[model samples]
Target chain A: MDRPASFLDEALSLDDGDSNNLQPWIGRVVLVEDCVETNGAFVLHHLIKRFLSPNLSSSDSIVIFVAFAQPFSHYDRILLPLGDRQGEGVPSKEAKRDIGDMDWRDLVTGLELAWVGGLGFAELGCNLVVQRENKRLIFFDMLMLECPDDGVEDGIIALYGNIQKAVEAVSSLNKNITIMIDDISLLEVAANGSTKDVLDFMHYCHTLTTQFACTIITVIHEDIYSSADHFTLPLQMEHLADIKIKAEPLVTGLAADVHGQLTILNKGSSDGLGRWKSKIRNFHYRVKENSVEYFYPGGRT
Target chain B: MATNKGRTSSFSRNFSAAPTSSIPGLKYGPNGTIFLSSGVPDLDKILGGGFHLGSLVMIMEDTEAPHHMLLLRNFMSQGLVHNQPILYASPSTNPRAFLGTLPTMLVSKDDRSRNTDAEQKDLRIAWQYKKYLGENKPHIEERDGKVEYCNEFDLRKPIEKHLIMGNRVECISLLDCSSLAGFRNSCSKFLSQLPRYDGNITSAGRIAIQSLCAPQCEYFDKEWDMLSFIRSLKSMVRSSNAVAFLTFPASLVSPSVSKRWQHLADTLLSVKAIPDEDKELANLLTGYQDMLGLLSVHKVARFNTQVPVILDATTYSIKLQKRRSLVLECLNQAPVDGSSGSSYGTSGSCSGSSKTGTLDF
Candidate 1:
């Protein structure tokens, strides 16, 4: 409640930490898809910062990063706060609730979630290196996972086994565990273009979600499957994801002020009756040196 | 960008902790990454200090014209010039023979001086501001010795056979491979020998695979196989000190499949051939006659960083400077009678452009 809630937080309903299940993201599947023009990797980085950063007490969770896209140094560099000067996202100077042109309603879904002097700022991003050192983070560097020609599944099967073992080992700890796949398209590639193998791998990951109080987050290049099961890889993930976050370039074009827009499709979490109601949140975001600025259309300060 | 500084002292980034490499044809970039020139100096500058050492650069070749060959030839030639190991795979029966057509490095010293003289004579100082005003500073191609970071290649003069024969330049004909597996094996074998980045990269390698998904090759129809090949190639290249440049015809493959290839590319570019007698296009832009094609930079690789590089203008007119070395210039819209069209400054910095008519010369 002390930290200022970004539009991304509101979309994922992370702002309301105590209301829903102790942690909404736990026991859920989150899918992020992006195109060539706009990369959605920032979402994964934000998620890592959110769960790992000790400031967010309610959602303090361990992260299992199965990186198919980039190395640890990359995520590490990004997740580290943008030097001493900048704080986590909302600089107190910019957090002044009274920008003449902007309306308070436009800030956070018109839900009266005005900035209550969130001038109390803590810099965004946690030191990934320190987290990994403390054994709270498990990183699988699959950058060199080259499956053999003899059989497609040999390499990926072992990779899945390793992930399962890591998850099981971590699950024993009382903390909520979240498994993150940097991307799935690359997984398909590692599986020698076998969508079946990739799907099988995801199915296995789904089992972990059920067996443990775990959440699964994955990234897939939506543009690849944009036209058509609409790509079986994305199709399966779509079915699995409780929250789907799509990052796409602006409809008009690229701009310096606006990096891209993210659409968060929240397929509501199960209630006592197990009824599902999906809600969609669309907003524009600008990625900065230290933090990401999320605002509504026609509502930037 | 403060983010560039990370949480650490900004000095560590601008001034790299890693000792500068004495290698030729390499430039230091942010995040401890070294960049290899993409052959064409202008192209290199346009793509923000050329391609990163370990990244996948994919060029979507134009369906009607072989414009991508110009890029591929220059990429391989730059590696050869730098004595960097090269593994070139092509659909041709004799990929080595194609190296015979590699352009010779232009005598940069004399030609550059000559070019400056010509520019001073032909282009007035009034219009010369266009170079620095709206665009990134033109990279200083400082030639210290036999090795140059980037060289202006003379397309007319073929590189000496001695240069091609002496270096560790490899050429694999796609016709020889029945499956991508065999080709991937050779690629992996070649990439394995290249140096990797531990603290500092001693040497780097370049891999140029032309027409990777061409129908002439045996694995043309197998979309997933090609995708996996590129995926693995990207992965292999990422760990090693190498740059893998691959070109595939976007028109030849299905849209969805082409999208997959585009997704995998760290740097994605597409080249389109200009029609010979498109009257409207001729009127729309100046210097229509000299243009060979248009180069659109879809994506520029941002290694070890999350920020996306958005170029001022994605499209550029690929014109052969003096009909020799390739030069990419911003499109200059012709001055319509009453409307007074803006010229080369695509970001609407046309205000600074001289009223030297539409003929920017």
Candidate 2:
């Protein structure tokens, strides 16, 4: 069975087709940079659901979610609103009313696509808890991580060791792995802005991609260092990523129909067909309770 | 806007629809979040609900004016009225004395007609629906003689001594704490008293820290230490059933540190003092003279959901009603001219007040 692609999937050149054996996004470092006025967390949520959804990748895949921003409860409820199962670890639930299914043509027509992101989580409803229980998802709650002045490197090294151990366990099972960090900026804050130690952690993570062919995705706020003369962290992150997705508040401002605009700059990515040429596409998105609707500018009435 | 109708409808229903306790000062909001009043009635309305329990509410202070005190006063007073534990920290040595200046609840409504209307509504539901009064009907109602959750305060009047003496109001001087670490220790000691229940709350506490990075404090120059303190404070407050209200002068600290504080705040707001005499602002909007300052909402805390609350208007002119109690009103265009959107440019000369109050953009 062949599934059509949304504008976002095409923008990132991620194929959802059935015949694809090798994943297109493996061994790539994808960076999502956002500003203060608009948070890029929704993009991270979208990517989480994308990797966990079986249609987009192999069923034997694992997603290592390291969240330094919000707790597991925040990401847990985004999967599906199992209000009846509220007794579980997650306290709150997503609003269930926005889970109506949609056809892929809705994405192309630039219509105000309904609340559901219309792809993975909408139909399959992959519960993060279930995924974690079945060994398909790994969540590390880092909200309470406060590194000391001298032990900054030690703390990051501990985290890197944990991730490497998890990667090792999954690799032997012939499972593809994706290590996702909700944000790297908070990582800096936890380290008290020790850039060198944070850079070391990134270098080690980069080595993991070469070692196991695991993909890594990170998010950082570009505006934080926009005025800095050196621009070390954001510049280093931009240079490291194979593809960059930037979410920005509209120059005009926020709107009811459109939450913010996302610009995807895709470097050449290899696939079953061939390496797609580097392309750039800008689209608008509206975040909903269960999913985020992506549409082109002026696509909706 | 049209597509969001269903989401918005469900949003409001989720607030009142949940089975919540008749906690005096606590109301159940969406996403399993309980709202504790920010002390100001109009502000509670502008923020959809008041500050959620466990949220770090940061106010970017106007360096030239003590406008942020208006918010701090109401916040402390509301907690005293509700009998919630309050731990207030200020840079001044006489932090305890500041509690005497807290505003008391306005018992008398100057608007007689509105007073009678509220009485009739509460009286109608006294026997039948008193127990079923949802959290949505947030008013000072005497249905079963239950204590009101939120109160309107008379800014001119100092709180009654009994109200201040009877409650668990703890005040600490920042001078007592040499560094932010010491200050953080005081916060943790105070927060340790009010533990949180899983999806259930016994009582909510209020922590108000005034001018956290003011020059007088010893840790004023320790920017990284202050940032780390805030970061630790954020994680601490998130686990307990309390709201930490901190105000810092954005102009005093470096811009990068200020930006980090904004990001850490669950609900971020900035207050800018209006000019004493601005002819351009006077001509551009109605009620220019009554406007005390402008409050712009930078962010609203989103708990479990990813959807952000995009308000129709972000900035509102802070005004006082009859110069007695605090009131917030959305600034409207002056009735003098029926000009279209093109005229916005001509009036917007100053950067602070340039934002058209009601315009969403």
Candidate 3:
């Protein structure tokens, strides 16, 4: 029996043509790194909300690295809680202990796995751990994941290897993952000894995204708080990114009140930035410690 | 004596009472009958209003066997008051070898009154005669005193009496001798003398050309090209702000020739013969059997006039039969007025205007 047709079916029939079969994905692959967005963290957030949502949210994931600068030599002290405030019954952080015990081989293998649980999984299997009532939540996570069997140099190499492996493996799996880097200057400091080392490190970070299908995001602050010339800074990384969104301070009054203004550049082929050029003038963000209140002027919704 | 004079003066005062309002210019100037009255009321109405100074005009008609030049000559008569000169040319008939072929006195007031009883009987005869001919016969009549046969007819005397006594010699009549064989050079020389009389001749000078083609039936050979040559002569007319009227043979040219002629002509008209058949039967047996002869009524192409109008033989039906009946019926049969209802009257004075523009010719 032929099914009765609806108004929608009739309307669709009018536009029925073989040309409609050629569907191209509307989103473009934008290599994001450097600048204040650090990477395509913002664009990735949007992609997840749009394409990966109700349709494929379970398959989508993001990865981040928590590491320290080289040559300091006490990875244990960096990872675990250093102060002895035992009588008060403060817990000796479990995540820092676990990280300090792992070797370079374990780190690389952990990155190869589909997912790596964040911080402490003994108490609760939280994909991400946020310290209760702590304004420096990012700093807390960084402190809880450190190398114990490694020197500062080995620990830096181990972290870098893990990041490269993770990006490459996820890209192979074709997982829609976004990688966020909080800072680039820490590597700048690690390469203070040699120009070749700095160049190598910069080249590695810049080209790492080339091997990965997953998008990478790096966040950097405007004020570096250290002396590094433009060439030594992540200039190579900045140049390779298909997009760069710069955050400038927009301060109104006294009392340390400040907001961020974003200047975005689109460099990707299939990106929707061409359309957004007319709509987005600037964005306002109020940064408090590790988290920020981002105000999109037009309201993203 | 004083009382008698007082009474007479009082009667005169009562008769010539003055107007209440102050009138400017001449006596009875603004609201006078002179302003209200059209020179020829019916003609003025067909012309939208009375003739005005500085109007460029043209009149064209295909000729019957005997020519009719007086209609154009009389039109120029009224035009003379404005100091307009008339230039007349006859390529088909030689006007210089002879005088006016058409009788100007045919429809005069005295002649009209005399024609009244004759008109009634003449119509009855024409009607019965057409019935005898049926449809196939060449509708014919007596072709006497034609331009081709007549040596002289004193036309100027009556024309001067009826049309030109008061009108200035500003009126010029050029009887073009150019169209006849061996007369082209002479006619050209005569036209060259026109510039000298520009002022002595009134602005109402009328020139009549006998035919569009140089030789008889030249139009049937190549219509469009011949019409262009005829149209080229209009430049000479425009140079002096004068009107050029063309006259051609009515029956000889083809339909295309008429169209080409009309394309060049700013105003076009056809003077056709009125068929005698439209009247009655017993008159055919009467003494004056050929009363319907060569007396034509003017068919005008009304252009640039206020009330879109055209007038031909049909305005006066009884008068129409005085000319060749076949030619008039052919003129009536022109496609321009086809499918017209009788409510509009023949000669087609129908109103076809939204705003003012050219007639849809």
Candidate 4:
């Protein structure tokens, strides 16, 4: 398996004209603070695209998306282009031919989805696992399995076991993986509103990142807890994370002028001092049809 | 010898002081203290970045007008958008109707711009520039680019689906409580569940008790029961992270009872509809054609002495804008007519004096 080109460089334009330089995002845990007003879905979408970049070996690179808040069908709509409207606006015959030649589903190999909802993914026409000649897309529906009790603890434990098994299976195939947890609050709900349980699971995830050489991206809605006492889970996750990103609606009231603010903090990187330092950057971002564009708040062409 | 003693004392004090954690459920301001958004950016600005966590904010409404309910709706809607759990206790109103009355999400100018070709072109051009600059540019560029300092929540969109699925709304009807003891029990039970119900997020949930004065007066057979209930509620707020919004109908309660409620609250806001006769005076003073009511911020919780007063006893003309934003502007001039002068003059003295005196000279 060959090492993949860094997608962050192309997607976010983080490259400094040095192709050899790799970002510190790998083998790290990142937590995204998001709210309804400021959606973090776009960031996750970009990250998935980055993981599935064509530079990587199709057989040796894998992407696992755990959908807790939404269904697998919703993600299918987001990640895959609409088939009927594929070449609608192309002016040239050549471009239309290119669209037809593109096999969008083959963009990522070993793509696995764990749908942790009451409704099974099979009902949405998603198979338990797709294992074609060389490519694979596995789907795990927790609701299909019987639980010992209706409590959140049992479900969370089951999820932990399944994720661990998946990681081990992918690692055996010698594939580098990236994991995304759609909403951590769902885990809290599963754990019966206990932050302690969520923290315990996060500790396990942190261990997985360090030991297994994987990247984990998770989102937590900050508005869920109003007081500091209830904020223990996110704060703890923030403390454990190597990188923390916050998504918020533009303060000036979402106007035609700006969409939202993306506050990224690379906590692992530091200045000359021995103390742990962080590089913080704020970007005003707008979601477009094909890409998420982030620019300096007031930057004009 | 005196200098050595002073230095030692200072060192000890520093060591004894506990490290401060960022306040939950509030955004950290440029200054040290944390500010919670009141769902209205302008109101948050006026109240020094919304109300502080753990503070009890009392909204006293004029029974005849009842327009202040809009503010309450805004507060709840803001919570819903932010994904903050709301524990609303109302005596008379149906909770579902209350939810329905909420204004739809505010459509931002940017949402409208997506339809324009020019805006799309500009966005494309901006995208190119962003790719070129990356993180190489100075931080000042980003700072200068910030157009607004306050966060706005769109009321038009439905609350996050998960929150709705999770049963985030804990609506308690005090009207159902047959006895004062039963009411107290229900309140205590509801308050007890709040901390546990809050999942991974640190924000303190919002607790709103509407028409506290009006309802309790009827529910509790004795005045003692009403006072005791309030006392218990105050203690609960003080100990927990929840920010409480207690609304009272000023006309229903006696002056003494109102005073007690005011004393218990950390911040006090009063809203009264401007009488038809006073409309001319309001127009003359504010120079605005559509002045709806008068808002007086009687008290602000003095948590930090260093923090300046966000809103004093300034009387502001409340205008319900097309976008559903509550605009509060200080009366630019004093009332000239003697008949209406006394009423506006006293309330307007705090803010209007400077403008009125300057104009006179």
User: For every model shown, what is its TM-score relative to the native structure?
Assistant: 0.84, 0.84, 0.28, 0.42
CA shift of A33, model 3, Å: 70
After TM-score superposition, what is the CA distance of residue B150 in candidate 2 from its true location, in Å?
1.5
Candidate 2 colliding pairs: none
Model 2 local distance difference test score: 0.74
Instruction: Output the lDDT of residue A268, model 2.
Output: 65
Tens-place lDDT digits, model 1, residues A186-231: 8877776677778888998898888896889899998888675556
On lDDT, the candidate that comes out on top is 1
User: Is 2 or 4 the stronger prediction by TM-score?
Assistant: 2
DockQ for every model, please: 0.27, 0.29, 0.00, 0.01
Error of 3 at B164 (Å): 11
The superposed Cα distance between candidate 3 and the true structure at residue B280, in angstroms, equals 7.7
TM-score of 2: 0.84
lDDT of 2 by residue, A94-161 (tens): 22222233222112111211222232223334567667877889998888777878887468889999
Better of 3 and 4 by lDDT: 4
Per-prediction backbone clash count: 2, 0, 40, 17
Interface RMS for model 4:
23.3
lDDT of 3 by residue, B45-127 (tens): 23323322212233334344232343444443333322333444444334433223222333333454346536644644644
Off by over 4 Å in 3: A1-301, B1-45, B49-70, B76-85, B97-202, B214-225, B279-344, B347-361
Best by DockQ: 2
